[model samples]
Target: MHETEVVGLNVQRRRRGWPTLDIGPFFMFFGIAGTDHGREARMERRFEQEYFSNAVTLHLASALSPGTYALHGLPEEANKRGWTVGPQGGNPTGHLSADGLDELRGWMRRTPSQRDRRVRPERMLPPA
Candidate 1:
């Protein structure tokens, strides 16, 4: 997935989508606990240097969005009630799925323009 894709998802949806995410390997400086010069302060700087030192954090975050350190995806099909509140109850909560493995029951109900890439999915939503 990409940053624009992640930008389209809410916190709940993001959590539902990437349930097994782990930050330990995405960045080399991860797990910086218990250091000599205050791990909190050093970790803060490490975050800045790793992500904001360049505008590439967008790509980094996006790439990290779809990963996991262990098992991936839901354990069963019946666990998808979380997507019921989405714009289209049948529409999958995933943004960039090629096959829409996470798509819900009414996937075909929405018009093609509603899924157009010319406009972002989140941009189509009503104001929160």
Candidate 2:
């Protein structure tokens, strides 16, 4: 999926205080924030990042919003690369099945536009 689409979904879900869904190859992480008036509020936050390879880390990070995100992916990848997942960089909550991925793909299709307005440049790329 496009990076902008992931960010849009994250922003939308965060605004609603819903948990973000992170779907990775071997594992998945779900983040939930606290809800308090202070900076540490108890808000439910859940998001998913797929890590097929080391390069995917950069790709996912670039796509994510500026904040602490829950990462999910293959355990072998994590072990070999010393990577972490989950709210506290621990274990994966669950793995996204083929059906789940299909559902997420459907959600992406249903979204209006998949562009990150914040990162968009004033002028089009390629000097258009």
Candidate 3:
């Protein structure tokens, strides 16, 4: 199922026989503990630099709306709810610094537009 609930709110709705949102790979990262770093902070830093520093992370962070990740996706009733409550029913939050915004804008301009890209069904999970 594409639907997911967070804090009493249902985010994303997929109907049978209807067109579905074709978000690519749903990456779930698992970190190996107690690797080279002895301390937790050092390990976390290394992990972020190595794993989190990727095109997918950058695109998601830049492309999504401020609260897009709050409840995993945009809430079904987001228009009615306004900014007070997030999609997850928690405080709405997400921000980018001035430099970050500039960088994102540059990257977006350089990247080819994906509007015409053909989506392959085989790459996506079947709708439930």
Candidate 4:
């Protein structure tokens, strides 16, 4: 089966893994570092480390309207795509289908800050 490897920030990675349907053949990885900035370079380094032939990485910076970042191996394709992120359409290998890419593009940031925050009930006093 075809696969499009997806590596996101730790929190983002976890959020998608649990309580969510696995999108197609997309695989997730975490702890690549340099996610806050220089993500493209980091992604390239990661690609080299993993030796992926047909894989894509999605780094969500804003997670707002259009803060999504998709690094590409080709400049021409990247220019043609415009602010859009993810793999090119009609990928036979299923590295990333058009609809799946669109789904990824529509994703929004669930966390308020760079790091994933959680509330702890243990820290709060018991109710009166």
Candidate 5:
């Protein structure tokens, strides 16, 4: 998986685990050092995943008090008609120190375009 700091990006290395191989199958990842307002301690378990043919991305962001989070992965359906997030959609696999599940479940931000939701007229489209 990919690791990127949304706020302060400190990229130590962004290359194959072993760069010597012309086409190495594995990538490298490093932990970030940051101050979090809060942290939920998941039970803790080994988490590792790798794909020989595709790339994955991850996002990490933290702020004071609380914020909303319902980032989407690729659309789950082959048709890509329905877009959703959280544990029910394009699920993220791994074990965390604390589930923070309730908090997570509470922040499934939805756009008006989602099913059953209507988009009100806006001033104008932001940009292309």
Candidate 6:
């Protein structure tokens, strides 16, 4: 019932549908791009148009999804390009380690409950 739990379940059940990519300092969602020249061209154009010079990990979803997934590691590619690439400790940018994937799975599974307890609609209101 928790958001994380829901996310975890969604990840697991939709594993084939969820394609994650490491962009740079954060992970982005890429679910609409296909593995084709056209997609790549579009990405390149978007990157140029957006002035995205930073290094990024691009994840393209193979399923009929509607979004893409990406992750950014550092402030800039020049600063962190030397760092190893892969998944590690549930982090998709630390060496592509299974541990990272497992960790992420766990986090996704546990996030919803924690969020529910920590956040409430009334909390957004101005203090009296």
Best candidate (score: lDDT): 4
Candidate 3 pairs with clashing backbones: none
Query: What's every prediction's RMSD, in angstroms?
Result: 16.3, 18.5, 18.9, 22.3, 18.6, 18.2
Write the residue-wise lDDT of candidate 1 on 16-109 in tens digits. 2222334545554765644244656756655534332211011111222221111122222312122222332322332222123233222323
TM-score list, all predictions: 0.16, 0.21, 0.20, 0.17, 0.16, 0.20
- lDDT of candidate 3 over 30-122, digit per residue (tens): 333333344466555554444322212221211222333322233222212122223434333323333433443443344456322111111
Q: Predict model 3's lDDT versus the native.
A: 0.29
Instruction: Point out where model 5 deviates above 4 Å.
Output: 1-91, 97-99, 109-128
CA lDDT, candidate 1, residue 125: 25
On the 0 to 100 scale, the lDDT of residue 77 in model 3 is 28
Clash number for each model:
1, 16, 0, 1, 4, 37
lDDT comparison, 3 vs 5, better candidate: 3
Estimate, for each residue in 1-128, the C-alpha lDDT of model 6 and write its tens digit: 11111111122211132333534333225445434446566665555433422322222121111221223322222122222223331212122223344443443345545542111011122238
Runs off by more than 4 Å, candidate 1: 1-38, 56-128
Alpha-carbon deviation at 71 in model 6, angstroms: 3.2
Local distance difference test, candidate 4: 0.30
Clash number for candidate 3: 0
Which pairs clash in the backbone of model 5? Answer: 41-97, 41-98, 42-97, 42-98
Q: Give the TM-score of candidate 1.
A: 0.16
Predicted candidate 2 versus true structure: per-residue lDDT over 1-128, tens digit per residue: 12221332221111233443333322423453433353223222122223221122222324332323233222222223222233433222223433443443454455457433222111112324
Report the candidate with higher TM-score, 1 versus 3: 3
What lDDT does model 1 reach? 0.28
